[model samples]
Target: MGIKSFQGARKHQQAGEEIPLKVSDYMTTKLITFKPDQSVEEVIDSLINNKISGGPVVNDKNELVGIISEGDCIKHISDSRYYNMPMDDDRIENRMVKNVETIDGNMNIFDAANKFLNEKRRRFPIVEAGKLVGQISQKDILKATMKLKSQNWKK
Candidate 1:
């Protein structure tokens, strides 16, 4: 006689039934945004107060214009010392990265992770209808992974 199996039959998941993990689900919606006219000194203050590396720069209409980070502020400070110029005179528009790359909210976390690795970026802004909706960081991806630790990752 064949040996009897003790374990119950495994359940198969239906196609498209399991919801994919998306970037929007883990992105931070309430962001500490900056303006182009703001001073580098102010940006430094906000970064320190919030304990963040950088923030998105937006216009009066809440449109993403650029991004400013600690690195940018540091460069501004260095230039100020070299040029013998006051630090307060420098504006974010001068130091901010105008060409910003954004990520789609609907993208799966795995694809987002690969993009992050390829881009070497700490965070990416999520835009909808040309408006800054949220931002996702490496830490957020880590959090998502931890949340799904018990589940198997789909290929």
Candidate 2:
């Protein structure tokens, strides 16, 4: 599939109409998170149960440390020689990653678009003071884009 674009979606279009865009505007604050110590099995369950690819991996202090994705889990499985599946692995600590890409909660939509383009991730964990606050998916940006386009077209 071709990569999506969020070029103009990032900027707030002030065409005599309200353009909806903000972390608080679209972010799901009550979203679930993962623990770095959580088992791979648990990560699988969370992914299935929550119906999401992955989530922010938080430290003991509930701070965003890294992100876990289905792709990450799959990488471990596809590369692993272990006979045991997720059960054999506990809490995905070893599999869980650390160097996560994050964004400030107060970051403008435009900034997020830039990060998304360069970072090459589907979603970003919103962090403030090193704490995990929320997350935004590509879907959010698409919604904002459509809203802006529709609003601008109406004028």
Candidate 3:
């Protein structure tokens, strides 16, 4: 989506024609976070159990550190086979993407959607005070759109 469409959405909201949705409004607050020192097997298990493709990696203090994904796990497995190493020997810190992109909870839904389109990221950790507060995904944006479509607006 372009900035013009997003601006139009904001205008629609300002004119009381549509609901103004924010990232915090639809973001998944109950997040499944991982630690940098955690084992790759545990990360895979967490991803499977949580029914998510990836999760943020946080320190003990709950600070946003990195991100781990299914792709990262697969690469770990591949590297292990090539290097004759064991899967359990690797840690999330070794495989996780340290340079991460994050979003603010108060950001508009359209802006978040635009980021998803441009950045090509599956999910983003929502930060408050540099700490992980929640996560938003493309699916979440779709859900917000569905919610908006279901609403009966006043003329």
Q: Comparing 2 and 3 by TM-score, which wins?
A: 3
Which digits, one per residue and each the tens of the lDDT, describe model 2 over residues 1-155? 99998755445565575655565566768877877777777888889998998888887898877788898888777756475554555456677667877776666676677888898888988877767778988787777666656444432
Best by lDDT: 1
TM-score of each: 0.88, 0.75, 0.84
Q: Give the alpha carbon lDDT tens digit for every residue of 1-155 in model 1.
A: 99999865545557776644999999999999999999999999999999999999999989999999999999998999999999988889999999999999998998999999999999999999999999999999999988765556765
Instruction: Assess candidate 1 and give its lDDT.
Output: 0.92
Per candidate, the number of residue pairs that clash is 0, 6, 0
Query: What lDDT score belongs to each candidate, Candidate 1 first?
Result: 0.92, 0.74, 0.88
Query: How much RMSD separates candidate 1 from the native structure?
Result: 4.5
Tens digits of per-residue lDDT, candidate 3, 1-155, equal 65554323322344445465789999998988998999999999988987889999999989999999999999999999999999998899999999999988888888899999999999999889877899999999999888776443342
- Which candidate ranks first by TM-score, i.e. highest? 1
lDDT computed for candidate 2:
0.74
